[model samples]
Target chain A: MSKQYLTTHTVDEAHPTEIFSVSPTPSSLFSASGSSALQIHSTTKGGFPLQQTITNAHRLGCHHVCTSRGGVGNVAASVGFGGEIKIWARQGSELLPQHEANGEWELRWEIAPTQTNGGDVWAVALSADESYLACTTSDGRIHVWDLTARERIQSYETGGSGTGGSFAMAVDLSRDGKLTATGHESGAVYVFNNNSGRLAYSLSGLAKSVRAVAFSPGCKRLAAAGDAGVIAIYDMERGEHVSNLSATSSRPAWITSLDWNDTGEYLLSGALDGKVKVWDVARGVCVATHSETEGALWSVRWLPKNERALEPGMGKGEMFCAAGANKSLTFYREATGI
Target chain B: MVRFPGQTVQETRKFEALFCILELAHEALLSGNLITLRNIYYQNMELFVSQAVVNVMIDSLASTLGVGRWDLNIGILLPSINSIEKIDFHSVKWVLVIEKEATFRTLAASQYHQTSKAGHGILITDANRLPLSQGARARLNSGSQRDRPTKRSRTDRGGDPVASITNKPFLQKAENRGVTSLQQSISTEYPEANHLGHEQRLEEELVHGVNENAISHHGAGDPVNSTMTLTQTDRKKVVSILNEICTGEGTVCTAVSMEQKQELQRMLVLNIKAEIQAVDHFGDITKWLDEKLCKW
Candidate 1:
């Protein structure tokens, strides 16, 4: 029998309008609010207690939040409507002051430029190691920054400008950094060579804006989905459409997020209608459907796989988290042994 | 020689004894009636090994029992980390995204909760806190300064062992889609990397639906943005006129004659087409054509 458990924690009514972004720590979860403040809550049941709160985090509401790829033990980054991106490193769950540069914690510390123009940063993505930070702007450009150097290294424009004009709404860097793919409002998905440093492919398929684009684990295939309500699979080598996937319930609702599994056999997508569907790429079928909430899901993520040598009774792999409108974070594990 | 059921001094005692014990254990485990075996093992402590050794023994026994190997197909639903870490093209094959933390945590911790007899190994971690790659590190590192973009060897990012792990995708799904901002390609300071046709093809396959049906309904089957013509002099004049007339204080002067409005519309459509042509992006521009022309 397939088993699924729904867990809910009542967070401090911190976010008045909506909880836009959330990040998970080992023992806790952090969330950003439309009220421009950042709050942390425990993940354990009856543990939705607000552990830490950063009031007035942004003069404007925070738009995005992300923890380092290293884990919640390290730094966390968030962007605001003010067009600024800030990193927050954990000093024992007490947010370390941005200026404090202690070495051990430095690797895990959060950062934000003391001064920035507030350029309307739309999206932010980090490397798995937490070494680099990339942000998309309303001006249709992607700026990659080195967290260690505190400098901007590469800037790739999506070739347009203005708010919602030709913005790079979504961007993902392949693990090896060989490729960079960005989904644009123009419904154009462009993949760049981070290594070769040139325009590689200008993908044109989605008739509507491409909201989410993800590269396979092997960086061989790219998956993108959006308003069309279909997940478009592409052969990274051929720059051609390999397949299009949609379930029976699939409609043209805007897909907000895309992620590839560890094995690259499945593709997961989150739609505006508060529905999550899993797609089997090899077989091209909907393997599962999960609907735990009706609130708009702002983000969906697979937990990092635990590859540490398995000890008896020790659990690793096949876990994921989803959070949004309700200001609560939910975790799910695979019920089947496989 | 140990004497037991269906065993004799001349019999193959090792195989028979082990098989009998395993069958008993299996029957007990399956029926949730381990008391018999528990009592027997308790009484004859020397007959069985420690639990750890027993687990291994049982694992081998279970495999030997002719049961099929457990096939675990891990799936994850996740989103955005492409900026900081590039997914290693070598590692994972599938992925999922979830909007809640409880969902992911419970799933990860469910190793203990799952009652399935077949054991499957799956890893679950926070999406934002996932592993990073070296190539992503270089790109991230190169941007420390606006003027000097740090350039690192791609191989360097791949050298780290952790980079290899995260290259694999995690699987999960959520109800509401995560907040995705616009994908803007507007900047001159930092140019995009070039991976030749590899990337182009990736995008085309992922973005452009080459399927006939997907292509057939495009822009009412007319390919609206297929043709556009506008000279630079005309574009410049149109911009100048719009800038002069659209000013906040007096921009809406006399509502402009319809003939001039028509002319302005023509100029605006051409300019919009030029702008559209100038950029590389996703989505169908045909739909945007009417909106752009209307705004013109």
Candidate 2:
């Protein structure tokens, strides 16, 4: 059965340039754009107020920013166009501040190639604990760094050699942190066994540049999407590509972002044409799709389950936000009959 | 398999071209920017080498998927086949004949065709391989056949490994148009890659289980970061050969791009920790690391 989502709130013109990525924590959403500053907004029931803005966070403008999905909203990672990565940690008192839903997260670790000599790191993801940061590079390599040790712990060369694979485009660590799945420019998706430190399975099917890859909350299913514009879902445990989710659009737009709901039931995907879709995993069909804006979308993410419990009538369903060329963070909520 | 810069020119060029294509497509898709193949070739001429090379690359990707080039948003470079039905050979300014292949290579590298002191000059190298060769001219004169994509046998419509496993109704409208073709060019182009494209998929199918031991750690904490650099022994600075290799080799393979590729080093992490534990026996660690690096 198809589901539905209503546009709840939108913070228009959130950034001066197009926002590249949007990551949501428990109580807040973090957005990074061409602008040097990173904006934090509260995911409250009514108005998704802009919470905190970190100015000069990325000197040459940020392209990717992600927060810990499974953590208590304490850690975050941002990658700037200048080939720099900075890890941010929330500070201040334990009590919730009056003006902010998510406390201020300060910059802690800076890996700037121009400064301390950082390598070329693109898309970054934080493990469940946010202790290990997994990043993808131009050359199809996935590196895992221990934030505490401040040393790179594990590096997975998806290229099958030392470092000669297709460009690893998108990456997502399973919530259990046992698996690291990367989607490459060649449209190949690989699932690495974090424990064995060996390639576990190289899932096939999608034969195009994969812009986004996501692991379900249960880590049982994985959904990947990109230039092909179709969402390919894989059986995570078996490492088999099980199905694909293509929107009703005749000419599918390149999908840029993907996120899973709390239950891993509905998969959310945002495409280049500014269409956001909610797919029913069991049915392998797009249950809900949003084409509210004509502009393209770069990032889409779901708020934690706790965010839904804010309103009584809303019921605990699902809430997701998408951003791209529109320069806005648009929030959508799954409609509940209650 | 650790292919550094200049290891194998062909494979590296293919990778370089594919990466540039995807990156351009990525940027264009995100901001709704429109770019053409001509623009891509000229803009990245230094990277792609030539326009014909770019056209071949795009054709391989687009035709294999059975999608319109426009779907990938790559436009044609306009073959510019305005062939003068008859050229006045008598009016030709000059004709330079180069017999040796070595001489041609050196001249081509210097772009002798355009840089030569002669004016209104057109250079044709390896004319037999050109589109208007003797066989093509005969067919064109007869007017029996127009332009059509030739079937290359190297990449046949073999049994689709992926199609065999899953039932994808998502693109059912496609009717499995080029399901087998998608795995043709991208994966098979790497000559040195013993098992990159098709064979790897079948291997993955045979291997089902994961490394359960790799799932030992179950630590979940507040996502935090520190200013600590590499491990230090109480202010006495220490650096390992592994650190240099990681950063140095990473820079070479990845080039100097804002796009960052990561190498998840759990394998290196395990070996390093094991070596640290057995520091009493130093030789054992080197041998062990050598074995691991070789396997990779």
Candidate 3:
């Protein structure tokens, strides 16, 4: 049976321009767009209020924003259209005496755009401990950096060899910190073993350009989606191809983002057609599908449920958020009575 | 004696915020009144700066105190009801306790109480008073007692900042709170008192804090916790507040530098607008509530 969901709240025109990316920590959602500033919406509050904003985060505007997937939520990294990656640290919102400084989300460091560091970093992911950072380049190379030392510790070549590999579109660090996975424009999804500094898996599933790759919370499964409009689940331990998640729609849209829930029981995906789907991992079914806008959806994420303040009759349920070309952020809550 | 000892600039501010929040929380716990984070934010806008600041502090304090969030008497505020005395439950038949604040707000705002049984009161309660979550209850089960350094020893060494307030006899405060008007019971005096409880006069240190935190710890086997984690620690525990209070050396950060207030203000330019809006809206919200709710 399909699980019923209700669109709880929508923040209209959250950004003046199309939102390009959205990521969530346990209590906050970081949203970035073609705007100079980055906005953070409080997921646990009413209407998901814009709790913080990092002004002039990117002079050229930002395209991607990602928070540490591990539970602590102490670190966040963002990519500007200028190809610069800025790292942010979550500090308790301190009362500062200035007209300008108002954010708890403070920028800690910046990696200036350069041909070095494996090519201009296109996508970035922070390890669970926030000690290591992994970034992908347009030349299909992935570089891992020890954040504390500010040094590139290892680099993996996707066979670009000074030319023609594929544009690395997405990257994610497994919560266990053992694996770093990336999706490339050549329809290639690669998993690198961080401990051994070797290529762990190169899977062929989506025949189209791969846009997103995410390691399940437990690190048991990896889900990837892109132009092929199909989500492929791969076994992380064995590097074997698993079941493909296909929608009943005749012309499926390119999936832009994928996130496995905290329990790994459910997967949340958003496509270019502005559709968000929740898939049950075990039963292999699209449990809930939502079409909030006809405009393209660039990103989607599952907001970590507020463990505190659960009222009576509020059976266990989930909450997820989506934002994109519509310039607004939409949040949906699982219909508990269902 | 001003040894913050190896703490970075950001940590110093975090501790400042922590101490500010704890002093207010200590007062709320003693006065026998519960306040939400939003409630705390409105009390001191200059200090908290924004609702988000208060939000961040609440989470950090709950994790640091090793106490329930409600144990801090901090929760989400309800905008529906201004007072309980105005609520006439005499004509009510069905008392509905709904889940989800949005639904509860909609139910209360839509005249659901009037339509229930065709003109009888439906006594909708403060949803914030809902039963504690499972994790919160397990934390309240009165974990085994272990001997620790005495507060007299710690305070004599001029180490513990919270020693003064949490040392008072908790029962006397509760009995004192019993005779006060309901408004006084729910109103807190901490934030307005000072940044820290030590600054408050000894004569005014009327309520016990951490012991009440412990009293509520043993309240699980009883249904007292059904009243939203409202339990007083054993009077002895209150008198010995620091004994089991600071667990895990208290809220250690893995390694992130904190920014100074001026630097934070500059970095958070976008948030300043929210702070302004919250200030302007505070009076309007109070006036709106007086017009919309108290009349009911």
Estimate TM-scores for all models.
Answer: 0.47, 0.52, 0.51
lDDT of each residue in B18-64, candidate 1, tens digit only? 55555665555576643222233333345454433333444565466
Q: After superposition, how far is residue B87 of candidate 3 from its true place, in Å?
A: 82
Ranking by TM-score: 2, 3, 1
Give stretches of model 2 more than 4 Å off.
A92-102, A114-119, A307-317, B1-296
Question: Model 1 segments beyond 4 Å from truth?
Answer: A1-14, A24-28, A41-51, A68-73, A92-119, A160-165, A306-317, B1-296
Residue A175 lDDT in candidate 3: 93
Candidate 3 docking: what grade? incorrect
Between the candidate structures 2 and 3, which one is better when assessed by TM-score? 2
Better of 1 and 3 by lDDT: 3
State each candidate's chain A TM-score.
0.79, 0.92, 0.93
TM-score of 3: 0.51
Instruction: Please report how far candidate 3 places residue B150 from its true position, in Å.
Output: 75
Candidate 2 chain A — worst ten consecutive residues by lDDT sum?
Answer: A93-102
For all predictions, the C-alpha RMSD in Å is 32.9, 24.3, 26.3
Query: Where does the lowest 10-residue lDDT sum fall in candidate 2 chain B?
Result: B146-155
lDDT tens digits by residue: candidate 1, A1-338: 22332332233345654566666544455677555578765443244456677776754456577654333335667875445677766554444433322222222333353322223466777765566777775446777878778887787766534223365667777765677788876778888877666778988878666767888878899988765668888888888988888766523445767777778886767665556666788888877667776645666665555544434432443655666555556555565454
